[model samples]
Target: MEFALAALFELFESLDQCAPGSRAATLQALQACEGLAPGARIVDFGCGPGPATVALAQAGYAVTAVDRHGPFIETVRRRAAAAGVGDRVTAIVGDMRAPDFADGAFDAVWSEGAAYSVGVPAALAAWRRLLAPAGWLVLSELCWREGARSAEAAAFWQREYPDMGDVTQLEARCAAAGYAVRGGFWLPADAWAAYYGPLEAAVPAVRARHPQAEAQAALDDIGREIALWRRFGGEFGYRFVVAQRG
Candidate 1:
């Protein structure tokens, strides 16, 4: 298990960007939320390489970017510095399953394509306690678009993440978790293009560098994921959910 996780992080590091959507998409999500005042303190869980973290920092929020991978944490630090938001961004190496912070430590918790690391339902339940009254939580989760299905896509997601659900279920989960559903939107095709387009283009180079079985499997898995997206993208997408602690 450790070896596989290491190989996964290795693959992640090779890519320039790890998550979907651009800074603009992140800003748009933030803008749609209320209670996220200027200079709000935000905790970015599983913030690989700090794309959204830096963007939030640039938007005048003080961000705490957390990821377990050391290299990704370093990348976040470097990127934050390059973006000149180092003062507002603090990169920390920590496990998302066990965030080390006091209760009500942040005004908002932002996660992009990373909430699945701790399971969406559990993440929603646990992280809600970390927020102050009326605090916001924003996450981008892979969601099943109701009534859209392909055997290939269904099989892939079932193998990769069996706990995935549709937007309505997620909204219900939010309400049950004591949060008011603030609204969310499906990430546009351009967002997937931004993440997978570069990744697909780099697969050959990445595969050639790592010839081990584990590495090859990782590469093939990524390719399969990209292919599945291309074939059944209309059936599902990354949904950005914004909810506030009530």
Candidate 2:
């Protein structure tokens, strides 16, 4: 697990950047929860490398970052410590699908391009339970127009995620889970470029540095995904804003 994560971090040179505004956008969307005090509780649900986790910590929030991958969790922990927020952020190795977080323990829950990793319904239902009353949950997920299911879109999302749906459907899931529809939008693909462009730059450096490494293969795969991301799934790529636990 550690080796896999290490490779991921090494190979995906710009993964942090490719992750939708270095997750600053996600943080901004979730700031609605700021109605809480500065030292409020925040959960970076499925936090890959602690972007939002560290940001929350820096903002004086007590943060808990959870990821199923052992190496990823380790990386989050190390980064938190290195970034001077180790004491403020508690790193937990766990799954986001059905996270083991205690009920209503958080002021906000942040999930960027991860809820779909777990089925949206399950992710929606599960994350809701972790929020304190009035807690906000911010998610940037794959969304498409309701009218069309092109063979291309279907094929792409099926391979990537069989359960993904349009933004409206996702919003319904949130309502079913007791969350209010606070805000939602069709996120522009430019965000993907922000994350991918930096990564694209890093690829050459990695290839040059590790000419014979497996990172090359991972880089190729990421490159392929990025190049085709919008083509196959552009209609559905979206971001959502919600609050719940009422």
Candidate 3:
């Protein structure tokens, strides 16, 4: 598990942005938040590289993009500047589990592919305090589609993320945590490709640089992850869950 995390972080840090999908997906996630008012103040929690942060700024929101990695925060600052949204974006280095912000500090809190790092239920509860009344909470989480589970896919995720749940379960959890689910949709297949394709392409070169047995093990683990998605993608995927503080 440590190697898996190290490999994942290494890959993301090497790139300009860490999360998956295109600019369109980012926009779509933002749009899905019915409670997010235009020109709102937002906290992009666990924002890696600020792809979504720049997108949110471009969409007219003032965003504070927070990530624990300094490089990721630097990337956000650079990208935001290049996009001419520097004034609207502030990149901060901090833990997602304990964001350094005052109570009711933001109109919305957005995270993509990062909430799971802190556990969804805990994230929903903790981050809710950062949002104003009726503020939006937009997050993309890995969830199983309703119905029978594919043995291969289920087994893979059991090892990868044992706490993962289905959409119905997530909605109930949100309600229990004092939020209302506005709407949500599963991320399209292209989203997975966007992240994996680049990582897959980089492996050969990266592998050559790492001839050590430990490095090989990490590479193998990453390879298996991509392969599982390729084979059993339909069995599970990310859901762009948009909720509002109640």
Candidate 4:
């Protein structure tokens, strides 16, 4: 289990790209939110390498992109600068389960699939405290209903997000967290196909180039996970969320 997760992390961190294109989806979701204006203060809970961060900054929002990894933070900062939005963006190294921001300091917060690495419920509970009045929160999480948990699926996610719950339960939990669940959209399946498919196919070359590295192994593991999803993705639900603080 630990090996799979470590491999998965290595694969993701090494990629110049990430999917389920949560970055693009989060940007689209945030566009539908209110009170996001020029200079609106926002924080990304687990922003990796600055896709949504770059987008948010490009859209004229004052953005703080946070991730626990120093390399990711540096990547985001460098990318933001190259994109010419560096002055408007801030990249920090911090974890979601224990973020390093002040209470009621941000008007918005964002999270991608990175929330699953920690625990979503705990992250939601902790970070909701940092939001200002009526602040917005956007999430792109992978989930499956409790009843839909097959032995195979359970085994698959047991190492992924063992704490994952269904979409309805997520709605209820967010509601209880003083939030108003606005809406959710199923992520574009074609995007997933495009990303994961090539990633799987890249294994051989990646293996040949760095046989001892975890990247190849992790990509293979994810490919297996994708194959499992192809078989039973119908039983699970993942999406983009827009929620407002109550």
Top model by TM-score, which number? 1
- Stretches off by above 4 angstroms in model 1 are 1-7
lDDT of each: 0.86, 0.72, 0.84, 0.76
Model 2 lDDT tens row, 1-246: 443345566754335532664445655665655486678888887788777788778878899988886666787788889989899999998878877768888888888777767777788878887888788877777776667667766776677677767667777888888888777655566776777777777777666665444556665666776766756654556665555555
Question: How displaced is residue 5 in candidate 4, in Å?
Answer: 7.8
RMSD value for candidate 1: 1.5
Off by over 4 Å in 2: 1-14, 145-151, 188-190, 202-221, 230-234
Whose TM-score is higher: candidate 1's or candidate 2's? 1
Off by over 4 Å in 4: 1-10, 22-24, 145-151, 209-219
In terms of lDDT, the best-performing candidate is 1
Q: Residue-wise lDDT of candidate 3 within 11-103, one digit each (tens)?
A: 667765555556777788788777576689999988888878998999999999998888889889989999999999988999878777899
Per-model TM-score, in order, reads 0.95, 0.79, 0.93, 0.85
Per-residue alpha-carbon lDDT of model 1 for 62-176, expressed as tens digits? 9999998889999989988998889999899998887889899999989999989888878888888889889998999889998958888888989999988999988888898
Worst 10 residues of 4 by lDDT: 206-215
How far in Å is the alpha carbon of 59 misplaced in model 2? 2.0
Candidate 1 weakest lDDT stretch, 10 residues: 1-10
